[model samples]
Target chain A: MMHLPNHWPYIAAAYGLTIGCSLVLGIGAALRLRRAKTRLAAVESQLRHRESSAS
Target chain B: MRPTPYLLHRYANPGQFLRLARALQPWLSTGAIIFLTVGIVWGLFFAPADWQQGETVRIMYVHVPMAWLASSCYLGLAICGLLSLVWRHPLADLAAIEIGPVGACAAALCLITGSLWGQPMWGTWWVWDARLTSVLVLFFLYLGHIALIRAFDEPARGQRAAAILALAGAIDLPIIKFSVQWWNTLHQPDSITLTGAPTMSMTMLWPLLITTIGFTLGVAAVIFARLSAAIHESRTRQLMARSRLNRSDRSAA
Candidate 1:
């Protein structure tokens, strides 16, 4: 097994911060997409119901 | 010759773009994850450490890619702004708005990682050198774009204002790119040149390239996902408004 370098903590901190920030943004965007899709589906379904009842 | 507007109009439709985005999102996200994992693993464990910087050099695998994405994101934002302003393209505005927050996040990452790298190598956590200062400015430009887009009660007005700001802020991109060369800065010059061979060895360069590609794909996936959400939100608002209007009309009759 390779021994970790003395500067391993700094390396870990840098990569950790970067990956953390990126994941937060990416996952946040994904969740927003899911919510928007659900909202749009609900709206469309409501419109369909209104049209069907009217006819 | 075919006019530019003719081509712009062809791809300006939101429905068509949403369809294309749906097809591309899965591929982009998957590729981003695979490449990022490979690049990080290769850079950290497989690549030889620098004679001077040792394991700290591994930070470059993330820092450089974030820096590149930060700059490229602004460029993309400016181009989308131009399309929004000149063509009044609906999708272009959505793309511009969606890119702002992601670009800001990337710029923030670049700054934070650069500071971390500097602490061990430069004996200092921060510097106001030309390259560093210019990148800070880039980060602010992204923030300004994000702020301007949501400043108004009317979304269209906000978008137009933000589009203008994005175009104006584009002047900073070149300054950030050439700051190390233009000024006597503490920062080193570019290691990778477009016309000349790279300064680093293939082992290091390969990981950098992979990470850069991964960052690009990752950014694209996030932006497209956000853009789709923005479109859907707009459609939902329109549908709700129309339904309310219909109810009001029936009551008025």
Candidate 2:
């Protein structure tokens, strides 16, 4: 086979950065979703409390 | 009346949309990771070096995708903004706000990576090429939308103002896409253009395309995830307001 350019390091760097950033973003978003779910649950429970008290 | 945009309608309902986003995010993120990994491995080690640019040409893998995404992010913003403006969809407004920061980050990444690539090739960290200038404008536009969205005291007013700004700035998208061909600019010709064929070989082209898809899906996952958070936050705020109103009424009684 013919010689390919020895740019493996740069290639690794670029792809690695992409992966790292994407992973951080994905994970961060997931965590946010979980937090939002929790907050929503709290609000729902509070609403239930108010409704039950009124009834 | 024209038929509704099917994809939009299919995913329009907030509960359904949340379910779909939850299902798709993991798979899309995985696809992004897999394709980007394989594409990079193949492009770096397997593909032959360019005749003219030699190793430096490898930067195209990162540069081209970033360049494409930098503007494409704006397009995403505009689409979501239009949906918010025309139909006043709550999800659309949420999407508009959610996508702003992500698009801004993507544009910033593009500029930084492009500058790094340019430093090696173009002999400077910066250039006034048409593509570069338009992309800079795009970055500013993303920032402007983000700021404008948060500027107003009323959330609805802020969203409407941001929607108008987003629609207005969409004009730059086409200018950025065609700037290479239109002007006497230093930016290289588009590897991917509106016309028939690409200038690059199959070996080089496939990886680029795959990575582009990967990047795009990756963007979608991020936007969806962020939008979920925004919607939840909005719901919480509404709950808080109702509770506050109740407390005030009780105290007055």
Candidate 3:
């Protein structure tokens, strides 16, 4: 494993890409989940209010 | 009920699906992060430099996984589309929709990483070789699915049209896989499946395997999250329509 006159750049590229892709995926999931939770809560509340009025 | 391998019945109802998604979210996110972190570190630092390719081979760690996910996500979308078309399952339609944008993103990642890898190894930024061209077509396939899904006034019509397109695009899967064999190109054939033995050592194999699993799980986790949002949005729309109908009836009374 002695082939490193200019190997670090490749390593950096690989690492940077791995981290960047993971970040995008993780953050995107979190934001979507948050938005879903909010919408679900709002709908649930609306349904509850409608049920109470009907009763 | 026991947690099955595929969790097939857990999604039988929208409510059940929502519950399972909420329960799985944390574990999926954690698994994605941990695997990616370990895989990248191992590949970048510990994997021995290739005897022939030197450090440029490190790009394989990123490029390979993205390519795999790009192709695989389309399959996922196609399967979802089939389920939706056959069963008229709203959840299945939501899944196809949810997976489309993410699949497109994965395709873009594949393209960018492949270009980066190519620049160092192949001496060019862009090439229209069989492998590259097929992957490019896969990207366009994904874009077409996404655009078609959003083009119609009726959401169900859009979903139906998109579903048809996705099933038709399944033809490209084999074409992409066999392009290197059918054409003489700069792109290498499947390293993992090619020849009698893998050309790389154990150190390289471990990281590649780990990264592939990581990327796949990461895509699934994101898709699940997106699906949850889509379900909520659809439900809200239905409830609003029902409420409007109720109001009109009450006024008529």
Candidate 4:
């Protein structure tokens, strides 16, 4: 099509790969943090309960 | 203390870092999104095609930024290495752990995107030239950092070893930068240099700059989030271990 530029496929592929990879990595970091925080909160509360019960 | 030392000492603790990172993370991530969107849209649609490479030159928007991030991230890793060794900055090891994987991602993206650009422009999918090889080596170094950081069951041992590796791998930074100039290579010399003006036109330069800023902020946001999580996880582990010890003592009694 006249609308499309030269080497459009390569351009598209390059952008696709870059954006896709960035999104995956970014999302992965967020999820890891979320999981870590959740576990930490649970453990902290448990320990607090243990301490209070012992006292 | 001097201003520099005052600030470093003030913020050296993990608690201070977490507070700062938490406050800054949203702004950095938002800026990354805004800048990246504008840069990409401007680059892909508004910018003129190159006289030499035509439309494929657009790939430079992403490729160039990835290249920059990969190298700069390595520099950051080296700084973490130094901090870990010199002061045993508590955040340094955790920072390195978070950065290693992200740097690896950036480096891998750099290599792949470079290949894509090279294929159409240079008529090859791959080359073993200095610039290319050095980047490949950089990528491997990132992987090696990841492996070493987790290789030991004791987290301190692993973090310390990775710190040393980061410091040593820093020697490659200069080599990568000078590869084109030092030896014959398919890769072109840098168009942009600290002492010289950019060889590129303003239109192309603007988008590239914006996208680069966005990418840098994005990296920071990710690292901050990862660091905060690592700290939380660490604190919980310590408490849990103490709790377990208490439980064992009571059971023995």
Candidate 2 - CAPRI tier?
Answer: acceptable
Off by over 4 Å in 2: A1-17, A53-55, B5-12
For residue B156, give model 1's deviation from the true position in Å.
2.4
Per-residue accuracy of model 4 over B1-253 as CA lDDT, tens digit each: 4776567677788888888988998999999999999999999999998888889889999999999999999999999999888987878888899899899999998888888888888989899999999999999999999999999989899988999999999999999999999999989899899999999999899999999998899888888988888898888889889989999999999
- Root-mean-square deviation of each candidate, in angstroms? 2.3, 3.0, 3.2, 2.2
Candidate 2: lDDT over CA atoms? 0.80
Residues B1-253, model 1: lDDT tens digits: 8898887786688788789899999999999999999999998899999877788999999999999999999999999889989888878888888898888988999999999889988989899999999999989989888998999999899999989999999999999889988999988899998989988999999999999999899999999899999999999999999999998998999
Off by over 4 Å in 3: A1-18, A50-55, B1-10, B194-196
* Fnat score for model 4: 0.77
Name the best candidate (by TM-score).
Answer: 1
- Check candidate 1 and list the clashing pairs: none
| Ranked candidates (DockQ, high to low) | 1, 4, 3, 2
Q: DockQ score of candidate 4?
A: 0.65
**C-alpha DockQ of every model:** 0.70, 0.47, 0.52, 0.65
Q: Tens-digit lDDT track for model 2 on B35-99?
A: 87887677667776788667767767766777777777788778878998887776877888888
Give i-RMS (Å) per prediction.
1.7, 2.5, 2.3, 1.8
lDDT by residue for model 3 (B89-141), tens: 65877888778878887788788877777776777878999888888999999
TM-score against truth, every candidate: 0.95, 0.88, 0.89, 0.95
RMSD of 3: 3.2
Whose lDDT is higher: candidate 1's or candidate 4's? 1
